[model samples]
Target: MAKQSTKNKLDTSALRPLLRYAKPHMWLFILSMVFAVITVATTLYAPILVGNAVDLIIAKGLVDFDGIINIIIKLSVTVTVTGIAQWLMSLCTNKITYCVVRDIRNDAFAKLQKLPLSYIDSHPHGDIISRIISDLEQVSDGLLMGFSQLFTGVCTIFGTLGFMLSINVKITLIVVILTPLSLFVARFIAKNTFKLFHQQSVARGDMTSLVEEMTGNQKVVTAFGYQEEAEEQFEEVNLKLQKVGLNATFFSSLTNPCTRFVNNLVYMAVGIVGALSVIKGVGFTVGNLSCFLTYANQYTKPFNEISGVITELQSAFASAKRVFEVIDETEEIPDSSNATVLTSVDGTLDVDNVSFSYVPDVKLIENFNLHVKSGQRTAIVGPTGCGKTTMINLLMRFYDTDSGEIRISGEPIKDCTRDSMRSMYGMVLQETWLKTGTIRENLCYGKPDASEEEMIAAAKSAHCHGFIKRLPKGYDTVISDSYSTISAGQKQLLCIARVMLSLPPMLILDEATSSIDTRTEILVQRAFEKMMQGRTSFIIAHRLSTIKNADTIIVMDSGHIVEQGSHDELMAKNGFYADLYNSQFAVT
Candidate 1:
């Protein structure tokens, strides 16, 4: 993992991640654009028909009622058909937008799975969740409403301008003058809004983190009587979010009204100019003047639409930038490009001069060396934070050693595929994490293809069958939400059963009996001893008495192995192991 100071900042320029989703729907986009152009052309033609109808009635005084009726019928059909076409275009736009958003969300989540644990530790869970949910939703809104409309509106503006110039070049020039001024105002508002929108997204992430923290730790707050403190902290985050939101809203608010004002000014100028041109006998007929006015009104529609879409575009761009930042993060502990799968294993393990640290410039394990013969039982004991758990992590290949190598069966773990390597070992942690399922399902977690008899036998070996059999539904009882119905010790036993079912050649027990009472711990220890027979095992324990009978007991301190031997040899030396034993279990 990179150092905190060097962690990549959110790069707004890394928005190409969205293209992976957009590419698949290019054909849909093309179809929608075709329909949109057709709709815009039909809409622009309607104004000309209306203007000609007025000229026939008022200027030439040639009513021709039947001809006027026929023109009206054709205009109605065109309007209806074009309206249906626009609706079809909207449906296509929505389909493409939804598929793109779905792909992005899926890719981002898959990337998270491959990310190192260190990244997760540094970043907030709620903040990550917010990006996946709220940020992606913002991107979807932009693609569906903003991008689609901007495409159609731009086409409409140019097409309308072309028709207006064809009807009367003088009026077209007057309308075209407002376009640059409107664009200038839009650019100015967009610059400020983008900055404010970025700030708002950050503030919102902070708020989400605060809320998640408070909710998850509510029990701690009540127990420690820190309700007021939690509330004050929440209020501070809320205030910051409010300030950022107000700033974003304030800038985005200016875009519409300013553009509309410019448009209204242009409309007034066109009216005045048209009246003068008529009185001066400049060959401006009633039809030409009416069409020019209609075209003038049509020109402002795109400007207004663009101004509105600018705000959404800024937000969408910000969301795209955030989502891409996550996708672009380098996987700190990536699998080796040439790594091969480990299909067979005998479980002999070796750690040779291994060194590691979670943070740079701080060593947690220094020149750590250990060797476990296949099918031997070994226990690691040390003071808190003496790198006992770190040793297990290195053995499991969760984090690569900063120096030296770790090997299984004489093969360096780094060269082995992660899945095939992990499949060879069964790990039981201090806390048992059970999904919402029946007892049978939890038991089969490790070896999903285990037969019923195999599951029952494993359960018996782990000392879990007795309790499970007492339940009304036995193995069929459904467990809900973290398996709250089971006792902590029962959950631990079930996890042990899960490991037993897998029957891997290697096993790791990291404080696996910490949650059970002393009597239950002794029972579990007996089951563990039986299970460890004929399998290489590494056990990390806080309770020294539980591991007293191990074949080898290694004592660690300050990232080095201070002492190692059988129980009697270590006690006879009266060194760090002796001191820890006397202090913890000596009994004054």
Candidate 2:
């Protein structure tokens, strides 16, 4: 079973990974703590100066002008020093926290690149985005606040307690007795609220996912008149989020007041007990009693602040746990240590005795095998869920074969470095992805070092140059997810052009032209023919007509290739391929 964090206890598992990122910044963190200590020391000492001033006024009345001036000057210097120290601590702590957060974000993103697509397919994109962006931000915020306040808060509490004890132990005992009440209140609130905050974080992620899902498919939502339905579904998720958020906030909000009430009781006890001690002539002066009261307030004030911050800390802890879960997922089964870089790829391929399944008990591809000559165009035709794409996945090593080897150019793929092996082929998916950048930048995405002449030639051949030139800024125009400046067909053409520019030794076009018009498909198919010269290509086309002239056609059913031949040969046999081919032209 996958592990889950216990609500109240911080998952040390999560903390260990976070600290791995923080290890390099250890000195900086220690320095921040030192600065915090200095700030707290100077701050606590100022209360002593205040007590001296009060004693000065009480001992000599208004006639003590010189003494009062000296005390004022000392107080001014002390406050100024404390402020400077506090500022320094703030500066160092912020640097340390953000730097640590930066490292964790970088690692989390890098982990995504190395993860298998199966993991991505099973998980929500919005949740992954939340872990990287929103969750990390929450974790960063908690660290920032903690670094700034934790050291100082801790030091002041103990320091003030010590100072109070020296001033009057009897009154200090009253504060000690009452301090547990604040802790208990904080604990009670924390125990109930941590689980709520965790649920709140999950709800927030679900809400982000809802927004992403709706906005990503706004066209479908509008085309089918699903606006009302979409809004209603969204309202359900939003309402759940509101309920979880309200409960979390309400419970956490109680901490401040409850702790403050206990603090007030302690304050009253300090005042009463200290007054009695002074009256009984226990050698506690008015100044000492004044200092003791100040110390008691100082000691307890941190508890209030800490109690308030506990809510944020728990939220951050939950976010950190989520982030670490993604990072800790077993990485794509690593290539062997002896794996060699794939080079001199000739495109000759062999799939030998391969078997696979998405689930252990449900077999998909069973002991399958195939071979293709170098520089040949192979077409794969199959109905949906016939293991067509799964075959491609195995070829690219996005997944491993269950029980056999795939060889490229007489070398086992398992023996080759995955990066070098995968780089040997160019792929175009059914969906097009264009970043928010200028036209030239997107065109140069794969081959950033390609010459302007090569990029322009690729675009012209892919039929994308005309549309790109028509944009308001031409090649320099910036675009985003809305794709306002181009149509879906144009985006696909650009993606094709990107692949053409890379010009790998082999190509895998999985529904590459699905978005284009029939007229445009002709142009793109012609370009594909031109690009296929002297290079091996694998075409997974639903429209069998597109691959009529392919050098070899492999027809698949379930997980096995049922027939193999050219169009005329398959038609002569009148097998499954022929029936499938004929069915496409049949009237309903």
Candidate 3:
């Protein structure tokens, strides 16, 4: 019902946002309009020269040969000038169309970077990508069509109307009186088609998202024998797109034919009226009637073209709305004017009575409190959905606590600049990410200016050196974040190497070793243990055996800390921690 109401409220107001992007290229648009005027002026004037040539050749022997030749020369000049002006007009419009869309794409991508993690978490990744890429492309096509046809169409209509009025006002009035019928037909079709076009745009985005998800994880789909089910899902979304797209195309297609029918009626009426005036000897002549007929066609032709422009504009506006939605979303909270920049972080952290939830009504974490001294290794263990990762999010300031204060190195995190605060910690998550670049580039991502020796040393320490050397190009081999070119374990090892390259004052390993094999995990664990010395570390682990030597072990359940102590002390108590540890290694 809400969507129905939104469709019903479609108006020209949504196009206002696109004007902001086009403003910088306003001069080019104005130049195109100027060229359009020259094109129209020359095009309309050529008919007058033709009418004069017809007047010169009165009757067989009464023809004035020299006058006919002069009119022909003037006609040739007008045609040449019109061609040049039209070409110039097209060139300017092309530049304006491409430049405006380019600016819009840049702004949309920059906005994506600034949005809060909650927004990214809630929305489908494919849909966001569609708005950025596919929707913007639609806007470009619409702008191009509008520029090429709309400006010249409007100018030609008015220019031809003036020429017709000068020839015979009575016949011009007949053309003007019937003009509204064409407009009415175009408007009726365009109004109904806008809703269908908008629906088509949304369906296309959904299809793109589904395809991205299925294809990116085809291995999982195949492993689970979900191919048939995936095909059914694709068919459902594809059918919805097909339905709306067909309806939109069907109605928009009616604009050209229906307007042309009305326009033809107007043309025939002018031809009859002008021919009768010439016959009755009411001051109209054969040449005047001929010129009026041409003017009449020129006048109504724009209605047909303009109607087509209206249809394309409707689709463009729908796409623009989607792209603007991303740009207008609320961004992450900005830093205060006097936000501190901590150059020397001691890695001390304090979570005081913190509470948070992704949704307002359903609480995930409440009154969560923890304190860690500088250089202490803290291991956070919990069952699935126990807010362990949420704690890390809070520490990294990816999402702020709803009702508490989190201080880093004794200063409130809210008062610190986000870049400086985030720079204090090097993070590696269970789900690895590596950009499309060389191995050395991925390792040096956290520290761009690191020496080659430092990069190889980190890779060696992470036990990925063997694989790195075996690759065709060693450190120069290119890789993508898709994890297609390399094994997941290799990707994880590269991520570990990334953190080691930076060696920030603090570290976060959230199931960081889950992808690697046991032998490699043991070797990486040793590297991490060595790296954690004298630096504060937060390890979110599921494998109990991996974090046995952590300085502090925090066991959590349902967003609350149930037990916390050293490994020996927690085992002695035999409480929640003991049961969790024993359950993992329990006998059948």
**Local distance difference test scores for all models:** 0.84, 0.86, 0.91
**Residue 553 alpha-carbon offset, candidate 2, angstroms:** 1.2
lDDT of 2 by residue, 1-588 (tens): 122345534546556776787789888878877887888888888888778777777543454678878988988998898898888888888888899889888889999998988999888898889888998898998787777777788888888888888777777888988987998899779767767877887888888888888898898999999999999999998999899989988999999899999999898888888888889878877777788888888889988877766767777777888888888888998889999898779999999999999889998998888999999999999899999999999999888888999999999998899989988999988878989888889889888999989999999989989988888888888976466568888889989999999999999999999999999899999999999998999999999899999999999998998999998999999999999999999999
Query: What clash pairs does model 2 have?
Result: none
| True lDDT of residue 283, candidate 1 | 84
Lowest lDDT 10-residue stretch of candidate 3: 4-13
Judge candidate 2 at residue 451 and give its lDDT.
Answer: 96
Candidate closest to the true structure, highest lDDT = 3
Candidate 1, run of 10 with poorest lDDT: 3-12
Clashes of each: 0, 0, 0
lDDT of 3 by residue, 370-398 (tens): 99999999999989999999999999999
